[model samples]
Target: MSKKVYLVGAGPGDIELLTLKGMKLLNRADVVLYDALVNPEIFQFCKDDVIKVNVGKRKDHHLKKQEEINELIVEYAQKHETVVRLKGGTPFVFGRGYEEVRFIVKAGFEPVVVSGVSSTTSVLESFMIPSIDREFSDAYRTITGHDMKSFSEIVTQYHSRENLVIMMGIHNLKQIVFTLLEKGYPSTLPIAILSKGTCKDAQQVVSTLGEIEQKDSLFFEQMKQLTPAIIFVGQTLNATQELIAK
Candidate 1:
Protein backbone atom coordinates (compact mmCIF):
# COMPACT_ATOMS: atom_id res chain seq x y z
CA MET A 1 0.00 0.00 0.00
CA SER A 2 3.03 2.31 -0.31
CA LYS A 3 2.41 5.40 -2.45
CA LYS A 4 4.23 5.37 -5.83
CA VAL A 5 3.85 6.43 -9.45
CA TYR A 6 4.48 4.10 -12.37
CA LEU A 7 5.31 5.50 -15.80
CA VAL A 8 4.25 2.90 -18.33
CA GLY A 9 4.34 2.64 -22.13
CA ALA A 10 1.12 1.42 -23.76
CA GLY A 11 2.83 0.52 -27.01
CA PRO A 12 1.39 1.77 -30.30
CA GLY A 13 -2.39 1.45 -30.45
CA ASP A 14 -2.68 -2.28 -30.00
CA ILE A 15 -3.91 -3.67 -26.68
CA GLU A 16 -2.03 -6.88 -27.40
CA LEU A 17 1.24 -4.95 -27.77
CA LEU A 18 1.32 -4.00 -24.07
CA THR A 19 4.02 -5.66 -22.03
CA LEU A 20 3.47 -7.93 -19.01
CA LYS A 21 4.95 -5.47 -16.52
CA GLY A 22 2.83 -2.65 -17.92
CA MET A 23 -0.33 -4.71 -17.53
CA LYS A 24 0.58 -5.64 -13.99
CA LEU A 25 1.06 -2.00 -12.99
CA LEU A 26 -2.16 -0.95 -14.69
CA ASN A 27 -4.06 -3.51 -12.67
CA ARG A 28 -2.43 -2.34 -9.44
CA ALA A 29 -2.94 1.36 -10.00
CA ASP A 30 -5.60 3.17 -7.98
CA VAL A 31 -5.50 6.14 -10.41
CA VAL A 32 -4.53 6.11 -14.10
CA LEU A 33 -3.69 9.11 -16.28
CA TYR A 34 -3.51 8.13 -19.93
CA ASP A 35 -2.56 9.97 -23.09
CA ALA A 36 -4.58 10.53 -26.27
CA LEU A 37 -2.68 7.98 -28.38
CA VAL A 38 -3.01 5.13 -25.83
CA ASN A 39 -5.72 2.58 -26.61
CA PRO A 40 -8.63 3.15 -24.21
CA GLU A 41 -9.17 -0.61 -24.33
CA ILE A 42 -6.22 -0.90 -21.94
CA PHE A 43 -8.55 0.22 -19.16
CA GLN A 44 -9.98 -3.27 -19.24
CA PHE A 45 -6.86 -4.44 -17.41
CA CYS A 46 -7.63 -2.29 -14.39
CA LYS A 47 -10.18 -3.14 -11.71
CA ASP A 48 -13.63 -1.72 -12.33
CA ASP A 49 -13.27 0.46 -9.23
CA VAL A 50 -10.14 2.24 -10.51
CA ILE A 51 -10.14 5.96 -11.32
CA LYS A 52 -9.11 6.87 -14.89
CA VAL A 53 -8.28 10.34 -16.16
CA ASN A 54 -7.66 11.35 -19.78
CA VAL A 55 -4.81 13.83 -20.13
CA GLY A 56 -4.02 13.32 -23.78
CA LYS A 57 -2.49 16.11 -25.84
CA ARG A 58 -2.91 16.70 -29.56
CA LYS A 59 -1.41 19.26 -31.93
CA ASP A 60 -3.23 22.61 -31.52
CA HIS A 61 -5.34 20.99 -28.81
CA HIS A 62 -4.13 20.08 -25.35
CA LEU A 63 -6.56 18.63 -22.86
CA LYS A 64 -4.03 19.20 -20.08
CA LYS A 65 -0.76 21.13 -20.04
CA GLN A 66 2.57 19.46 -19.13
CA GLU A 67 2.80 21.19 -15.75
CA GLU A 68 -0.76 20.16 -15.03
CA ILE A 69 -0.02 16.57 -15.89
CA ASN A 70 3.11 16.48 -13.74
CA GLU A 71 1.15 17.97 -10.86
CA LEU A 72 -1.56 15.35 -11.23
CA ILE A 73 0.98 12.52 -11.15
CA VAL A 74 2.40 13.83 -7.90
CA GLU A 75 -1.01 14.62 -6.49
CA TYR A 76 -2.36 11.18 -7.26
CA ALA A 77 0.74 9.48 -5.86
CA GLN A 78 0.35 11.33 -2.57
CA LYS A 79 -3.29 10.35 -2.21
CA HIS A 80 -3.44 6.95 -3.88
CA GLU A 81 -1.47 3.80 -3.06
CA THR A 82 -0.51 3.40 -6.72
CA VAL A 83 -0.76 5.85 -9.63
CA VAL A 84 -0.14 5.15 -13.30
CA ARG A 85 0.71 7.49 -16.15
CA LEU A 86 0.30 5.56 -19.39
CA LYS A 87 1.65 6.98 -22.63
CA GLY A 88 1.59 5.93 -26.28
CA GLY A 89 4.71 4.48 -27.85
CA THR A 90 7.73 4.14 -25.58
CA PRO A 91 7.56 6.58 -22.71
CA PHE A 92 10.90 8.21 -23.53
CA VAL A 93 10.46 8.07 -27.30
CA PHE A 94 8.91 11.50 -27.95
CA GLY A 95 6.09 10.89 -25.47
CA ARG A 96 7.49 13.31 -22.81
CA GLY A 97 7.52 10.47 -20.27
CA TYR A 98 10.99 11.52 -19.12
CA GLU A 99 9.81 14.97 -18.13
CA GLU A 100 7.12 13.43 -15.99
CA VAL A 101 9.62 11.18 -14.24
CA ARG A 102 11.91 14.14 -13.57
CA PHE A 103 9.08 16.06 -11.95
CA ILE A 104 8.06 13.03 -9.94
CA VAL A 105 11.61 12.73 -8.61
CA LYS A 106 11.73 16.40 -7.70
CA ALA A 107 8.57 15.82 -5.70
CA GLY A 108 10.49 13.23 -3.62
CA PHE A 109 8.96 10.13 -5.22
CA GLU A 110 10.99 7.58 -7.16
CA PRO A 111 8.93 6.51 -10.16
CA VAL A 112 9.00 3.04 -11.67
CA VAL A 113 9.41 2.80 -15.47
CA VAL A 114 7.87 -0.07 -17.45
CA SER A 115 9.10 -0.41 -21.02
CA GLY A 116 6.67 -0.99 -23.87
CA VAL A 117 7.10 -1.73 -27.58
CA SER A 118 8.10 1.55 -29.21
CA SER A 119 6.23 2.55 -32.34
CA THR A 120 9.49 3.57 -34.04
CA THR A 121 10.63 -0.03 -34.54
CA SER A 122 7.37 -1.98 -34.31
CA VAL A 123 5.30 0.21 -36.65
CA LEU A 124 7.88 0.25 -39.46
CA GLU A 125 8.60 -3.45 -39.08
CA SER A 126 4.88 -4.25 -39.25
CA PHE A 127 5.10 -3.14 -42.90
CA MET A 128 8.28 -5.22 -43.54
CA ILE A 129 10.58 -2.19 -43.65
CA PRO A 130 13.86 -3.02 -41.96
CA SER A 131 15.52 -0.22 -40.04
CA ILE A 132 18.76 -2.09 -40.33
CA ASP A 133 19.65 -4.71 -42.96
CA ARG A 134 22.99 -6.49 -42.89
CA GLU A 135 23.61 -5.85 -46.56
CA PHE A 136 22.02 -2.41 -46.85
CA SER A 137 22.31 -0.36 -43.64
CA ASP A 138 24.59 -0.17 -40.61
CA ALA A 139 23.06 2.81 -38.79
CA TYR A 140 19.61 4.32 -38.38
CA ARG A 141 18.62 7.70 -36.93
CA THR A 142 15.32 8.18 -35.07
CA ILE A 143 14.40 11.86 -35.41
CA THR A 144 11.54 14.30 -35.03
CA GLY A 145 10.05 15.79 -38.18
CA HIS A 146 7.89 18.24 -36.24
CA ASP A 147 10.55 20.95 -36.20
CA MET A 148 11.90 21.80 -39.67
CA LYS A 149 14.72 24.01 -38.39
CA SER A 150 16.23 21.52 -35.94
CA PHE A 151 15.67 18.64 -38.38
CA SER A 152 17.67 20.44 -41.11
CA GLU A 153 20.38 21.30 -38.63
CA ILE A 154 20.86 17.76 -37.25
CA VAL A 155 20.59 15.88 -40.56
CA THR A 156 23.36 17.77 -42.33
CA GLN A 157 24.57 14.80 -44.36
CA TYR A 158 22.84 11.84 -45.96
CA HIS A 159 24.85 8.64 -46.22
CA SER A 160 23.53 5.75 -48.26
CA ARG A 161 24.23 3.32 -45.44
CA GLU A 162 22.19 5.19 -42.85
CA ASN A 163 18.41 5.14 -42.38
CA LEU A 164 16.16 7.92 -41.07
CA VAL A 165 12.96 7.18 -39.11
CA ILE A 166 11.05 10.39 -38.55
CA MET A 167 8.16 10.67 -36.05
CA MET A 168 5.27 13.18 -35.83
CA GLY A 169 6.22 14.20 -39.35
CA ILE A 170 3.27 13.45 -41.60
CA HIS A 171 1.94 17.01 -41.26
CA ASN A 172 5.24 18.45 -42.46
CA LEU A 173 5.95 15.87 -45.13
CA LYS A 174 6.33 18.28 -48.06
CA GLN A 175 8.55 20.65 -46.11
CA ILE A 176 10.69 17.79 -44.85
CA VAL A 177 11.17 16.46 -48.38
CA PHE A 178 12.05 19.91 -49.73
CA THR A 179 14.55 20.49 -46.95
CA LEU A 180 16.21 17.13 -47.52
CA LEU A 181 16.42 17.78 -51.26
CA GLU A 182 18.00 21.19 -50.60
CA LYS A 183 20.50 19.49 -48.27
CA GLY A 184 21.63 17.22 -51.14
CA TYR A 185 19.62 14.08 -50.42
CA PRO A 186 19.08 12.36 -53.75
CA SER A 187 15.82 13.14 -55.50
CA THR A 188 15.50 9.36 -55.94
CA LEU A 189 15.92 8.64 -52.24
CA PRO A 190 13.11 6.30 -51.16
CA ILE A 191 10.50 7.67 -48.71
CA ALA A 192 7.70 5.76 -47.04
CA ILE A 193 5.01 7.21 -44.79
CA LEU A 194 3.27 4.63 -42.63
CA SER A 195 0.03 5.82 -41.03
CA LYS A 196 -1.69 4.46 -37.90
CA GLY A 197 1.07 1.94 -37.75
CA THR A 198 0.47 -1.40 -35.98
CA CYS A 199 -3.29 -0.78 -36.01
CA LYS A 200 -5.75 -2.71 -38.17
CA ASP A 201 -6.34 0.47 -40.20
CA ALA A 202 -2.67 0.99 -40.97
CA GLN A 203 -1.83 2.43 -44.41
CA GLN A 204 1.45 3.17 -46.13
CA VAL A 205 2.61 5.15 -49.18
CA VAL A 206 6.02 4.51 -50.70
CA SER A 207 7.63 6.90 -53.16
CA THR A 208 10.89 8.66 -53.91
CA LEU A 209 11.68 12.11 -52.58
CA GLY A 210 11.36 13.61 -56.04
CA GLU A 211 8.00 11.96 -56.68
CA ILE A 212 6.47 13.57 -53.60
CA GLU A 213 7.92 16.95 -54.54
CA GLN A 214 6.31 16.89 -57.96
CA LYS A 215 2.83 16.32 -56.51
CA ASP A 216 0.28 19.12 -56.23
CA SER A 217 -0.51 20.87 -52.95
CA LEU A 218 -3.85 19.10 -52.94
CA PHE A 219 -2.04 15.81 -52.68
CA PHE A 220 -0.10 17.03 -49.67
CA GLU A 221 -3.34 18.28 -48.14
CA GLN A 222 -4.82 14.83 -48.42
CA MET A 223 -1.78 13.42 -46.63
CA LYS A 224 -2.30 15.67 -43.62
CA GLN A 225 -5.23 13.46 -42.70
CA LEU A 226 -2.72 10.84 -41.57
CA THR A 227 -1.12 12.39 -38.47
CA PRO A 228 0.27 9.59 -36.34
CA ALA A 229 2.49 8.33 -39.16
CA ILE A 230 6.21 7.63 -39.46
CA ILE A 231 8.39 8.77 -42.39
CA PHE A 232 11.31 6.50 -43.27
CA VAL A 233 14.00 7.41 -45.82
CA GLY A 234 16.87 5.24 -46.99
CA GLN A 235 18.15 2.59 -49.42
CA THR A 236 16.70 -0.22 -47.29
CA LEU A 237 13.29 0.87 -48.54
CA ASN A 238 14.34 -0.25 -52.01
CA ALA A 239 14.99 -3.73 -50.66
CA THR A 240 11.43 -3.84 -49.36
CA GLN A 241 10.23 -2.95 -52.86
CA GLU A 242 12.36 -5.69 -54.38
CA LEU A 243 10.87 -8.27 -52.03
CA ILE A 244 7.31 -7.10 -52.71
CA ALA A 245 7.90 -7.16 -56.47
CA LYS A 246 9.15 -10.74 -56.30
Candidate 2:
Protein backbone atom coordinates (compact mmCIF):
# COMPACT_ATOMS: atom_id res chain seq x y z
CA MET A 1 0.00 0.00 0.00
CA SER A 2 1.30 3.47 -0.91
CA LYS A 3 1.50 5.98 1.92
CA LYS A 4 0.51 9.64 1.70
CA VAL A 5 2.67 12.69 1.09
CA TYR A 6 2.11 15.57 3.51
CA LEU A 7 3.20 19.05 2.42
CA VAL A 8 3.67 20.88 5.71
CA GLY A 9 4.32 24.58 6.16
CA ALA A 10 7.17 25.13 8.68
CA GLY A 11 6.16 28.74 9.14
CA PRO A 12 8.33 31.87 9.04
CA GLY A 13 11.62 31.20 10.86
CA ASP A 14 10.08 30.25 14.23
CA ILE A 15 9.45 26.64 15.21
CA GLU A 16 6.77 27.64 17.73
CA LEU A 17 4.78 29.14 14.88
CA LEU A 18 4.27 25.70 13.31
CA THR A 19 0.77 24.27 13.54
CA LEU A 20 0.03 21.51 16.03
CA LYS A 21 -1.29 19.22 13.31
CA GLY A 22 1.79 19.77 11.14
CA MET A 23 4.15 19.21 14.06
CA LYS A 24 2.38 16.00 14.95
CA LEU A 25 2.91 14.72 11.43
CA LEU A 26 6.60 15.65 11.59
CA ASN A 27 7.12 13.62 14.76
CA ARG A 28 5.65 10.49 13.18
CA ALA A 29 6.84 10.92 9.63
CA ASP A 30 9.11 8.20 8.29
CA VAL A 31 10.76 10.59 5.87
CA VAL A 32 10.97 14.22 6.97
CA LEU A 33 12.28 16.17 3.97
CA TYR A 34 12.84 19.90 4.43
CA ASP A 35 14.13 23.01 2.68
CA ALA A 36 17.23 25.02 3.68
CA LEU A 37 15.40 27.94 5.23
CA VAL A 38 13.36 25.91 7.74
CA ASN A 39 14.26 26.30 11.43
CA PRO A 40 16.28 23.29 12.60
CA GLU A 41 14.57 23.45 15.99
CA ILE A 42 11.42 21.99 14.47
CA PHE A 43 13.21 18.69 13.92
CA GLN A 44 13.67 18.16 17.69
CA PHE A 45 10.12 16.86 17.89
CA CYS A 46 10.75 14.12 15.36
CA LYS A 47 11.93 10.70 16.49
CA ASP A 48 15.52 9.60 15.96
CA ASP A 49 14.43 7.11 13.29
CA VAL A 50 12.98 9.76 11.03
CA ILE A 51 14.93 10.46 7.82
CA LYS A 52 15.70 14.09 7.08
CA VAL A 53 16.71 15.37 3.64
CA ASN A 54 17.71 18.91 2.70
CA VAL A 55 16.82 19.99 -0.84
CA GLY A 56 16.54 23.72 -1.17
CA LYS A 57 16.56 25.21 -4.69
CA ARG A 58 18.73 28.28 -4.64
CA LYS A 59 19.72 30.52 -7.59
CA ASP A 60 21.09 28.49 -10.50
CA HIS A 61 21.42 25.49 -8.21
CA HIS A 62 19.11 22.68 -7.17
CA LEU A 63 19.78 19.42 -5.39
CA LYS A 64 16.92 17.86 -7.34
CA LYS A 65 14.70 18.90 -10.18
CA GLN A 66 10.91 18.95 -10.06
CA GLU A 67 10.70 15.59 -11.80
CA GLU A 68 13.32 14.14 -9.47
CA ILE A 69 11.59 15.46 -6.34
CA ASN A 70 8.27 14.15 -7.55
CA GLU A 71 9.86 10.77 -8.03
CA LEU A 72 11.34 10.92 -4.52
CA ILE A 73 7.94 11.67 -3.00
CA VAL A 74 6.42 8.64 -4.68
CA GLU A 75 9.48 6.48 -4.08
CA TYR A 76 9.76 7.35 -0.39
CA ALA A 77 6.06 6.92 0.34
CA GLN A 78 6.01 3.49 -1.26
CA LYS A 79 8.80 2.32 1.04
CA HIS A 80 8.33 4.45 4.14
CA GLU A 81 5.14 4.60 6.17
CA THR A 82 4.77 8.37 5.87
CA VAL A 83 6.53 11.21 4.05
CA VAL A 84 6.56 14.84 5.19
CA ARG A 85 7.64 17.59 2.81
CA LEU A 86 8.48 20.45 5.17
CA LYS A 87 9.12 23.90 3.72
CA GLY A 88 9.74 27.41 5.01
CA GLY A 89 6.89 29.88 4.88
CA THR A 90 3.71 28.60 3.20
CA PRO A 91 4.57 25.56 1.11
CA PHE A 92 2.51 27.06 -1.68
CA VAL A 93 4.22 30.44 -1.54
CA PHE A 94 6.92 30.35 -4.24
CA GLY A 95 8.09 27.10 -2.70
CA ARG A 96 6.65 24.90 -5.50
CA GLY A 97 4.50 22.96 -3.04
CA TYR A 98 1.69 22.96 -5.60
CA GLU A 99 3.95 21.51 -8.26
CA GLU A 100 5.03 18.72 -5.94
CA VAL A 101 1.44 18.02 -5.00
CA ARG A 102 0.46 17.84 -8.67
CA PHE A 103 3.29 15.50 -9.51
CA ILE A 104 2.77 13.15 -6.58
CA VAL A 105 -0.96 13.05 -7.22
CA LYS A 106 -0.26 12.10 -10.81
CA ALA A 107 1.97 9.31 -9.53
CA GLY A 108 -1.01 7.83 -7.63
CA PHE A 109 -0.47 9.49 -4.27
CA GLU A 110 -2.74 11.82 -2.33
CA PRO A 111 -0.95 14.83 -0.83
CA VAL A 112 -2.39 16.44 2.28
CA VAL A 113 -1.85 20.11 2.98
CA VAL A 114 -1.31 21.51 6.46
CA SER A 115 -1.25 25.29 6.49
CA GLY A 116 1.00 27.09 8.96
CA VAL A 117 1.98 30.70 9.61
CA SER A 118 3.55 32.19 6.47
CA SER A 119 6.13 34.97 6.25
CA THR A 120 3.55 37.21 4.66
CA THR A 121 2.21 37.57 8.19
CA SER A 122 5.07 36.76 10.57
CA VAL A 123 7.79 38.70 8.70
CA LEU A 124 5.65 41.78 8.54
CA GLU A 125 4.44 41.14 12.06
CA SER A 126 8.07 41.01 13.26
CA PHE A 127 8.57 44.51 11.91
CA MET A 128 5.07 45.44 13.09
CA ILE A 129 4.01 45.85 9.48
CA PRO A 130 0.43 45.02 8.68
CA SER A 131 -0.35 43.57 5.25
CA ILE A 132 -3.87 44.90 5.23
CA ASP A 133 -6.01 47.28 7.29
CA ARG A 134 -9.42 48.78 6.74
CA GLU A 135 -8.31 52.34 6.15
CA PHE A 136 -4.95 51.55 4.52
CA SER A 137 -5.69 48.74 2.12
CA ASP A 138 -8.79 47.28 0.58
CA ALA A 139 -7.06 43.96 -0.08
CA TYR A 140 -3.60 42.37 -0.34
CA ARG A 141 -1.92 39.86 -2.62
CA THR A 142 1.17 37.62 -2.50
CA ILE A 143 3.27 37.29 -5.64
CA THR A 144 6.66 35.98 -6.83
CA GLY A 145 9.67 37.76 -8.31
CA HIS A 146 11.14 34.93 -10.25
CA ASP A 147 10.86 35.30 -14.01
CA MET A 148 9.52 37.85 -16.43
CA LYS A 149 6.39 35.85 -17.04
CA SER A 150 5.67 35.56 -13.30
CA PHE A 151 6.27 39.27 -12.76
CA SER A 152 4.10 40.11 -15.76
CA GLU A 153 1.36 37.88 -14.45
CA ILE A 154 1.41 39.73 -11.14
CA VAL A 155 1.15 43.15 -12.79
CA THR A 156 -1.73 41.95 -14.93
CA GLN A 157 -3.59 40.44 -12.01
CA TYR A 158 -3.03 43.23 -9.50
CA HIS A 159 -3.22 46.89 -10.57
CA SER A 160 -5.39 48.68 -8.06
CA ARG A 161 -4.91 50.35 -4.68
CA GLU A 162 -4.24 47.20 -2.67
CA ASN A 163 -1.54 45.70 -0.53
CA LEU A 164 0.92 43.54 -2.46
CA VAL A 165 3.31 41.01 -0.95
CA ILE A 166 6.22 39.64 -2.98
CA MET A 167 8.23 36.56 -2.00
CA MET A 168 11.69 35.42 -3.21
CA GLY A 169 12.01 38.68 -5.10
CA ILE A 170 15.55 39.84 -4.43
CA HIS A 171 16.96 38.48 -7.66
CA ASN A 172 14.47 40.29 -9.82
CA LEU A 173 14.11 43.50 -7.83
CA LYS A 174 14.99 45.74 -10.75
CA GLN A 175 12.64 43.98 -13.13
CA ILE A 176 9.92 43.96 -10.51
CA VAL A 177 10.31 47.69 -9.97
CA PHE A 178 10.29 48.46 -13.67
CA THR A 179 7.29 46.28 -14.38
CA LEU A 180 5.22 47.57 -11.45
CA LEU A 181 6.08 51.15 -12.32
CA GLU A 182 5.23 50.64 -15.98
CA LYS A 183 1.93 49.16 -14.89
CA GLY A 184 1.17 52.44 -13.09
CA TYR A 185 1.64 51.32 -9.49
CA PRO A 186 3.00 54.82 -8.70
CA SER A 187 6.66 55.81 -8.59
CA THR A 188 6.30 56.44 -4.87
CA LEU A 189 4.06 53.47 -4.18
CA PRO A 190 5.90 52.78 -0.93
CA ILE A 191 7.72 49.42 -0.87
CA ALA A 192 9.35 47.50 1.93
CA ILE A 193 11.70 44.54 1.40
CA LEU A 194 12.22 42.35 4.46
CA SER A 195 15.53 40.44 4.20
CA LYS A 196 16.09 37.12 5.99
CA GLY A 197 12.52 37.52 7.00
CA THR A 198 11.52 36.52 10.52
CA CYS A 199 15.12 35.57 11.44
CA LYS A 200 17.89 37.15 13.47
CA ASP A 201 19.83 39.96 11.70
CA ALA A 202 16.72 40.48 9.58
CA GLN A 203 16.89 43.76 7.66
CA GLN A 204 14.00 45.81 6.38
CA VAL A 205 14.54 48.26 3.52
CA VAL A 206 11.68 50.68 3.10
CA SER A 207 11.77 52.52 -0.19
CA THR A 208 9.87 53.15 -3.36
CA LEU A 209 10.44 51.20 -6.59
CA GLY A 210 12.67 53.92 -8.00
CA GLU A 211 14.63 54.45 -4.80
CA ILE A 212 15.27 50.87 -3.64
CA GLU A 213 18.77 50.55 -5.12
CA GLN A 214 19.74 54.08 -4.23
CA LYS A 215 18.58 53.83 -0.64
CA ASP A 216 20.73 50.90 0.41
CA SER A 217 24.28 49.83 -0.54
CA LEU A 218 23.65 46.37 0.87
CA PHE A 219 20.84 45.96 -1.63
CA PHE A 220 23.42 45.29 -4.34
CA GLU A 221 25.42 42.90 -2.14
CA GLN A 222 22.28 41.15 -0.98
CA MET A 223 21.10 40.70 -4.54
CA LYS A 224 24.03 38.28 -4.87
CA GLN A 225 22.69 35.63 -2.47
CA LEU A 226 19.75 36.74 -0.41
CA THR A 227 17.46 34.56 1.67
CA PRO A 228 13.70 34.45 1.61
CA ALA A 229 12.12 37.88 2.09
CA ILE A 230 8.70 39.49 1.77
CA ILE A 231 8.13 42.67 -0.26
CA PHE A 232 5.18 44.94 0.57
CA VAL A 233 3.79 47.60 -1.75
CA GLY A 234 1.07 50.25 -1.45
CA GLN A 235 -0.31 52.24 1.48
CA THR A 236 0.24 49.25 3.72
CA LEU A 237 3.93 50.16 3.73
CA ASN A 238 3.19 53.65 5.10
CA ALA A 239 0.71 52.41 7.69
CA THR A 240 3.31 50.17 9.33
CA GLN A 241 5.62 52.98 10.49
CA GLU A 242 3.60 53.75 13.61
CA LEU A 243 3.33 50.10 14.57
CA ILE A 244 7.07 49.47 14.03
CA ALA A 245 7.98 52.18 16.52
CA LYS A 246 6.06 50.45 19.31
Best by lDDT: 1
What's the true lDDT of residue 43 in model 2? 91
Q: Estimate each model's TM-score.
A: 0.97, 0.87
lDDT of 2 by residue, 75-165 (tens): 8888888899998877887678898988888888888999878887788888877777776877778777777786786477345558878
In the predicted model 1, the residue pairs found to clash are: none
Looking at model 2, report the run of 10 residues with the lowest lDDT sum: 212-221
Among the numbered candidates, top TM-score falls to 1
Can you write out model 1's per-residue Cα lDDT over 1-246, one digit (the tens) per residue?
334688899998889999999999988889999999988889999999999999999888999999999999999888888899998987888988889988999998988888889999999889999999988899999999999999999999889899999998888999999998998899999999898988889999999999999999998988888878899999999889999999
